[model samples]
Each structure stands twice: as structure tokens, then as C-alpha cells.
Target: MRELAGRQDDEGHGRVLERAAEAIEQASGREVIPGGDGELAGELRYALAADVVLGATYTGTLPELHPGERLALVAVCALAAAMPGCVLGDLERELTLLAGELDQAVAAGRAATAAAASRA
Candidate 1:
């Protein structure tokens, strides 16, 4: 059961990374330059802010989260920090994806706890 939970967390983290990459790519139109200067800095800042806001909203909506969910959220924020651009469409998608993942994690955690309690 522990292993199963671990796998779920790992998968969730991977999804967050994957979605971040997709959002970044979409925002930059498949163009990601190296280093943080000028345009890069601006884009990075936008992405980081978006991530922070989205994560805060998620935590506010679901205050009761497991350690794994919190870790996943942090990973998502890190990924967002690496993203770029402030396109409204991409930002909306990013927020939507983050919220959806958070919801899924919370639901899974609740289900797991309920199942464990039932067994006990």
C-alpha cells in the first residue's frame, strides 16, 4: 500500500512537470532561450508569478492535503518558475491544469484515507 501511494505521488509529480513543459512550450511558441536576461527574465517572472498564484489558490481551496500533495504542489511551482511568457490563453490553461491536478490529488488522498479507515 505504501508502494502504491508512492507510485501515485511520483506519477502526479511527473504530470505536473509534463504540464509545465507543455505550457512553457505553448507560451514561447517552442522557443526557449538559455540564461535569464531581458526577455527571458520577464517571461520567467510571469511564469513564476502565475505558478505562485495558482498554487496559493489551490491550497486555499483544499486546506487539508497530505505531505505528498504538498510536495507535488511545490514541484509544480518549480516547474512553473522555469516556464515563460504571459499569454492569457496559456496562463488560463496553466491555472486550469494546476487546479485540476490539485483536485485530483486531494480526492485521491481522501479516498485512500477512507479506504484505510474502513479496513481498520
Candidate 2:
């Protein structure tokens, strides 16, 4: 039962992250190359922030995320916002790492719940 709940949570979180990534990509325009330095970074940062806010709204519920998770999310958001050039690839990598961390947290939570259940 707990496993099911955890899986649901994980799936839901994955969807949210995907949407956030998509939003960021869409707002900033696809096929970002490389170069443009300062101007590109500024544009990316703004777009990323907008995407995060959009994702937050899409989820309906406020994120009850841990500090570390929140920070990672924000870091990725900021990175996307301040992308150096048309570096969509780099931004995607950062987002992937952030999502992985979130997945680890969800797995840990599920494990904890399972341990408690076993004890009970």
C-alpha cells in the first residue's frame, strides 16, 4: 500500500518536472545553440523563472518540498533562466540532475515508510 502511494507520488513529481522543463524550453524557444553570453543568460533566467511558476501553478498544491529539493529546483530554474547561449543541452542536463535528486528523495521517503510498516 505504501509502495503504491510512493509510486504515485514519484510519477506525479516526474510529470511536474517534465512540464517545467517543457515550459522553460518553449518560453525560451527550442534549438538554442551556443554563444550570446550575457544577453542569453539573462533571457534564460527570466524564462526559467516563469516556467517554475507555471509548474507550481499546474500542480495546484503548494510544493511541500524539502529545503534541499527546493534549492536544487531553484538552481535549475536559475540556470535555465540564465542560459549562456543556445545551450539547451546544458540546461537539460541540469534539469535531469535535479529530477534525479528529487527521485532519490522520493525513494528514500518510500523506504522509510516501508521500514515503519515492517516494524508495525
Candidate 3:
């Protein structure tokens, strides 16, 4: 949480990291999927939701994670930090594709208009 706060770009994924971190610390390695070979957004949401539920479960519910499990949790958190950039990059690609499609559509419409004008 302190590490996230000290970050210069603390938003988006950062918010998730801080929130997820709070839950991961209390969750077993198996309980948290981190990215789970799935979409970052979905995985992050799941981890956060699970965290909240587990947090509310009761006292002593979150026992100490084994050293290996703890390592996995740390890895999950680290991967989450990178997920935001990957998601943003995918969105940019989609936007670029959409723009190209729109350009083609506009060009076709202009050509149609010109053709109709010549006939008239």
C-alpha cells in the first residue's frame, strides 16, 4: 500500500493494486488468482471481490500464507501492476482499427457522392 502511494502515476491499475494488495495479504495463494491466465481486468476484479468477502468472513480466517504461497501472491501483485498498460495498449489498437474502418467508410461515401454527381 505504501509502495503504491509513493508511485508518481497512482491511478487506474494503481488503485486496483492498492485494493488488491490489502486482500492478497490475507488470502492464500490459491484463494487469489492474480491474473489467472485470464484478462487482467476480470482477474483484478475477482481478486478484489474475493478480498472483500474474505475480509468480512471473520477473525483468524486469513491464516499466514506459506513462504511459497506468499511469493506467488507477490508475483500476482506485480503482474497486476503491468496489466493496466497491456489493457490500455489493446484499447489503443482497437481505436486505431476503428479509425481505419471509419476512414474507408468515409472515402467510399465520398466516391459514391462524386459518382452520383457526375451522372446528374
Clashes of 2: 5
Which scores higher on lDDT, 1 or 3?
A: 1
How many pairs of residues collide in each model? Answer: 0, 5, 0
How much is the lDDT of residue 34 in candidate 2? 52
Q: Give me the runs in candidate 1 sitting further than 4 Å from their true place.
A: 1-89
lDDT of 3 at 36: 46
State which candidate has the highest lDDT: 2
Q: Model 3 TM-score? A: 0.27
lDDT of 1 by residue, 1-120 (tens): 222223333444333334444554443443333332313354444543434213224333332334454444455444444333323235557645654664564466456556666666
CA lDDT scores, all candidates in order: 0.42, 0.46, 0.41
lDDT of 2: 0.46
Model 2 regions more than 4 Å off: 1-15, 23-32, 35-47, 50-55, 58-60, 85-120
Taking all chains together, each candidate's TM-score versus the true structure is 0.31, 0.37, 0.27
Would you list the rank order by TM-score, best first? 2, 1, 3
lDDT of 2 by residue, 59-84 (tens): 56643343244444555455444443
Candidate 3 stretches with Cα past 4 Å from truth are: 1-89
Cα lDDT, model 3, residue 81: 36
Per-residue error for 88 in candidate 2, Å, reads 15
